[model samples]
Target: MNTVTRPRILVVGAGFAGVECVRRLERKLSPDEADVTLVTPFAYQLYLPLLPQVASGVLTPQSIAVSLRRSKKYRTRIIPGGAIGVDLKSKVCVIRTITDQIVNEPYDYIVLAPGSITRTFDIPGLTDHAFGMKTLAEAAYIRDHVISQLDLADASQDPVERASRLQFVVVGGGYAGTETAACLQRLTHAAVKRYPRLDPGLIKWHLIDIAPKLMPELGEKLGSSAQEILRRRGIEISLGVSIAKAGPEEVTFTDGRVIPTRTLIWTAGVVASPLIATLGAETVKGRLAVAPEMNLPGNDGVFALGDSAAVPDLAKGDGAMCPPTAQHALRQGRHVADNVIASLRGGPMRPYVHKDLGLVVDLGGTDAVSKPLGIELRGVPAQAVARGYHWSALRTNVAKTRVMTNWLLNAVAGDDFVRTGFQARKAARLKDFEYTDAYLTPEQVRAHVEGTARQE
Candidate 1:
């Protein structure tokens, strides 16, 4: 039997939660005491709050993807893999490596922070026809898709198809949906000036939501102001409605309004990664339930945080769970780290409690809406505050510099709207993202075993 001397801590993500756990472990433990490992598909911590900017071409995609390995070399071993499942009874995790290999790793302690995937609904033709604005790839694809639509419209002779191609519809009124519509519209406005043949008046952006107000989190006054600004920009805001159906050439809304368009960006919201539900533990709103200590109930050395775990917001009464936001995720990550360190040293675990900081909505261009530290601001000052917050929130200096440089260049030279046309063929397929399942089918596994037996 192989004897292990050092304590092993396996973290199942590189996002706010996992990263925070690793950082704390490194700071608290000496090199001789423990080893920290982070398992994530990508080597970067995605700054999700600014993902809409990437989609809208306000900032390049790389600006938001801070390199995980580079930032945490002193703390943990970064494994490039997607965690598939956990054997909580054995403290083992099954991870699928980027190279398509699955391996089980044992650990003394575990932290689950797998984050989330787009929360999709059962609307007809939605998954097959709509574009998503969740990840880095999705943002890049959206930029290309938008530019390509403009290109196709500019070259097309059919007025109806051109109009259809020019029309862009975004579902959801949360930060993601609202910012996506705002930024993309700004992009189209800037780009159409370079396209002489295309009439800018023909291009339209529609923001739809089932909620009564756009950016309802911003309070009624600020939300109304934002809605008015978007409306002034020639964007349509539809409330109390959602996309009923999406097709290759058209979309039908719940309000019985049909619009012909090739673009439908779905940013309704996010749900915890399905892996959390598979843990067989109590969950709140589909997230793994965690104690105030950030530890799994009745399980020693196991913890969860971030979007994947439904940690209580004691700050809010009546058993409220923390909203899945980057700010909360970040604080939870740090708190979880502290709790883990306390557990290791036989110290008391502290309850996590953080007051709500203000939210920022970057509307692209020189317009923004923000409430920083409970102070509200709009227009260019709000835009500056929004961008400033994102800049300061980034993990590393390099990320900050890169994002600033991109902003400077964008302001000076304007948008490039250059379509890469890479993901065009793979567009319109959820299966292409490898989201449903990552493992081989039973038949395929059996066939593989048979082939191996014959070879032997």
Candidate 2:
């Protein structure tokens, strides 16, 4: 082993931003310059954009999850755990490893790309009921739960229980909610063919949002087109309505309507990870406020980006911050890497600038809408653009091949509609996946680091 010491660089989270940063750092930085260490709960950088397809059985979970250890020359030290807290003054990160052991990691330079978690309101019984689509496991679990619901409903004799099992409700009108509702609806639509007893008519899907327009960012014409398509497919598209309360077997809407449903998918939106709050830094709407260069003001060695950082959108101007999208996060990662390297070499840093690439919504099968380069498209043309974008975005040849093969197989042979007993529960809430409550307070972080120091 080389005896010469180098500056220790630590990166948290393996999402788009963190992964891209690490990859760029590895390629750009020589071994003598800096040592990069990545902290994450998973070994793979999940392609989160295709999560809905995984939930709907269009693509296998492994297809989107690209492994980080793809090269034998990989030198970055990997910590398979989550950073519960960060002490900026001490330059140490408190981590909870996969085995539930707590440890302290000191760094010369640290990147905070912990990303976002599901945004849940104080609505009654939300924690007891509602499912999420933020993680791979959540997506897989949802697939199993939906399949199980169909099985249970088909095997039931009681009309009430069967009816309740057949109804599904999805909350949120953004890309996640719309795509999830659309993909899962198609899953059930194709699945009912396997069930002889369950009438396809009995299966109902309700996609509602508190926002007046569905996918408002897509502009009025495309938004209306998407709504019309969903409505024509027997899905009840309700705007300006939301869940008043969620229960084990029902969801009460804000409009005084009570619908019985065993499945409640809450994709309302996401908030910055509570991990960012451990720094006790200034934040804008729960996201860490960073300068245009994606660094904390006054904290020279620390940087934040992705969903957790409120990066100023210099390209958009007028005091607008970049939206928490994969597009922005991926680009920010590369830019932040350049900035970090610049800081290390005493070079000047440049602000992040990205041109709008537009949006794509794959509403299952040939029905879709997209705005690439400000030009609107619909039907097969839009679907082509959507899939093509996702396919091109895959990080590895193996991942791309797996995804393409899975897509082809799914298109030709179709899904078996099977459920893995991975999640052995009737209902799982958002709390089960993301450990938001597990984040340590600032005082605790200081104590933990000090305690670890004394022990060392």
Candidate 3:
């Protein structure tokens, strides 16, 4: 009797690209043709764009965290772990399981989509004093921390302490920083109503960025429109300036200006996943270098996408690589799956080419700005477009329903201004939340793999 061998495919990370790749693979290939395995610490794909809403109590975390196991049609075996290293020559991936067990996952083909980490600078006290807005835990902690500041300020008799507590400084004018400042500012605005003893005039929000413009991707016209909205809302906008030093109670800008504040939210930018360096391959900026089809050059059976890979933008056609965005990630996920299957079947592979759809910035409430397909829109029309795009992008029906319901509930009932006291019990800092120190070096990777092999 002759037996047929099936190919095994492994996908790392459960972000937008990873999840979409698995979904496409499950739908395209039969169970007898290949076996699919996914490596991730969490079983859910976080809708990262809505994270600011989660931070501001506009939506629950569960609503944006779409479960990977929700579909009965999903047949991929999920390894509840994070990939720490990859040996291209050995075709083996080193994964640290949630239980802290190190294991090797060998595969016929592997996809790296580990995603990005919050980018930080070397400024003094930045890592120790600032809070990040890159993950769900950080968002939740920020919400709690913000409300706690209000609670503490309300109870304080010291004028200086109260003033410091009421002042907020957000660094970064990109989409993440801008949205974060806008949403959390709205949170404080509504929250102050509950604190009758607190002076509303004392509450201040300062948004500073090293860039000359806010949301520059929105273009000059729409970007200025968004900035106007924020400025009208009393948000202090500072361009071409950044934090020179961060302290526990105050931050000094490079312009030699000092501001007193207990809260500092950092959303400056993101760097490609540290796992990219494990491959020791060519890289663009910090992302792994890959063909337009998302295949790693000179490395057979290896593919990369999402924030981890520098994929060429064939649509623009001027040697420009695709910008790291959810739009590109989602499309790249599906396209890379197709290319992988082509490789498996000895068929032709297609290159990834996509055009920019537009940009959207929701500045809390009905205030928003958007440019869809080059049509500039602001106010209520832009809000509709922004919400419409997000609603359409949600992966599951349940997530969509939950998010919509949360939006409606938040609109009708308003935020309750409650803090869960998470930051009070533990320190919430950049390093504390991101775990940047936990990643392994190349030497450590080899040692761990050899040690595990010896034990086995």
Best by TM-score: 2
**Backbone clashes in model 1, listed as residue pairs:** none
TM-score of each: 0.94, 0.98, 0.97
Instruction: Report every candidate's CA lDDT.
Output: 0.84, 0.93, 0.91
Give the distance in Å from residue 129's predicted Cα in candidate 1 to where it truly belongs: 0.8
TM-score of 1: 0.94
Record all residue pairs in model 3 with backbone atoms less than 3 Å apart, i.e. clashing. Answer: none
Indicate the worst ten consecutive residues by lDDT in candidate 1: 439-448
Cα lDDT of candidate 3 equals: 0.91
Cα lDDT of model 2 by residue, 195-218, tens digit: 999999999999999999999999
Q: Native-vs-model 2 lDDT?
A: 0.93
**Candidates 1 and 2: which is better by lDDT?**
2
lDDT of 1 at 454: 73
RMSD of each: 3.8, 1.3, 1.5
Tens-place lDDT per residue, model 1, 86-167, is 6676566777898988767778888899998888899899888988877788888889889999899999999999999999
Candidate 3 Cα outliers beyond 4 Å, as residue runs: 1-4, 450-456
